[model samples]
Target: MAAKPRVATCSLTGCFGCHMSLLDIDERIIDLIGLVDFDKSPIDDIKSFTGPVDVGIIEGGVSNDENVEVLRSFREHCGVLVAVGECALTGGVPSMRNLVPLKECLEEAYLKGPTLVGGAIPNDPEIPLLLDRVYPCHEVVRIDYMLPGCPPSADVLWTALAALLKGEEPKLGYELIKYD
Candidate 1:
């Protein structure tokens, strides 16, 4: 029997709505489960993947220094990387705040403002300090494919998943966020 393709997935710097939307595929995901072996899906239980996966799905923007590393790592590990949400493709709503300076934004949040103690500094280096702008995933690293929607509709995700599993490029040329 041929080896099933492996897939890795992650969310970098945005709300996890896109990840949750994958569940919108209902039992169709069960069909997909048979086609590919997910190596690093955040929804699944795992940590630190180094496998040579066939596809990688990134679902958020590159909002800081760490996001840069995440994008690069995914690119290095996966053969075909797919940016799977508006945040991953065009930076989505998070990129809108790119117009503001980082210091002023921080000031407005903690110092001379509304939050409790005015400020509390974290000591961890992994914690992002904030940048002048938010970058989409592809801007930080090469993306083999992109699906642009705040949270792309389930049909779009399912179709993309199926095509990808079949070793064909998925076309995300249609809209996926409307329901009437």
Candidate 2:
């Protein structure tokens, strides 16, 4: 028998709501589980892996060095890469904080009053600094698919996935769901 297509997923620096959305697919996910093989989802049953991944859905913006690694790795492995959620699409809520300086954010969270002392700031040598603003996945690397929403409506996801599975157009040129 031929092997099922492989799909790998991960969440970078977001609320992890996208992951929950996938889980919320209910019986559709059960059907998907049978149709596609999951390799390195954040919810993977396995701990670590090193193999070619077919479809990579990244759910968050690139905020630091690790995010760069994650994005590159996913692009390298996956035949088709997808960026899910507003965070992955446009850096989402986290990028909204970009209005404030990194130091100000750090101090507000962990330097001034009611903050952590001896702090290991995230953008330092050991950590990674964020860019000035949020950008969508395609801005960094080529993206095969992009699902943009603060958290995209599940109905939209279902329709897109169904089209993909059928080997038909998946709302690439036309609008599947209206956006504000």
Candidate 3:
């Protein structure tokens, strides 16, 4: 018998809603585990990629230098890369900042916002530097597939993974794909 395919997931610059949606598949996750061996995923809480991944599901836009590095690493190590959710596909809500200068956005959040008494824009060596604009995963690395939605429904994720596991095109129904 053959080993199950290796799967990994990562979240970069969006809310964790997409990972939650994957969990929304609920009990079906047992079936998913039976088909694929999860590698580096938040669900597993594994911090580093352990081995070559067969499928890498990325769940956020790239908004900083660290994001770029991680996405590129995924591209290097995964056989198939999936950009899941509106954030991963198009930068989604995070891209709203593209309309404003990055400096102004940082200033508002760190220095000038009403919440602060004496806050200054953080200039720590440990902090990841923000990029000029939020970018989709594809802008940072090659993406083999895209599952688009604010948070792709559990059905969409399941169907896509099932087909990919079987080495077939993910034939999503019109209703399963949404952009809003």
The lDDT of each candidate is 0.80, 0.74, 0.92
Which ranking of candidates, highest TM-score first? 3, 1, 2
Task: Report the CA-based lDDT of candidate 2 relative to the real structure.
Answer: 0.74
**Candidate 2 local lDDT, 1-180, one digit each (tens):** 977877788887788887887777778888888888888877775433468866778899887767777788889988878888888887888888878886687677765646466765454577666666566577788888878766766656766666765666568335544331
Candidate 1 vs candidate 3: which has greater TM-score? 3
Worst 10 residues of 2 by lDDT: 171-180
What lDDT would candidate 1 get against the real structure?
0.80
For candidate 2, the per-residue lDDT at 29 reads: 82
Clash tally, candidates in order: 0, 0, 0
Residue 90, candidate 1: C-alpha displacement in angstroms: 1.3
Per-prediction TM-score? 0.90, 0.83, 0.97
Q: Residues 62-159, candidate 3: write the lDDT tens digits.
A: 99999999899889889999999999999999999999999999989988988799988888989999999999998888899999988999999999
Q: Residue 162 of candidate 1: its Cα lDDT? A: 83
Backbone steric clashes in candidate 2, count: 0
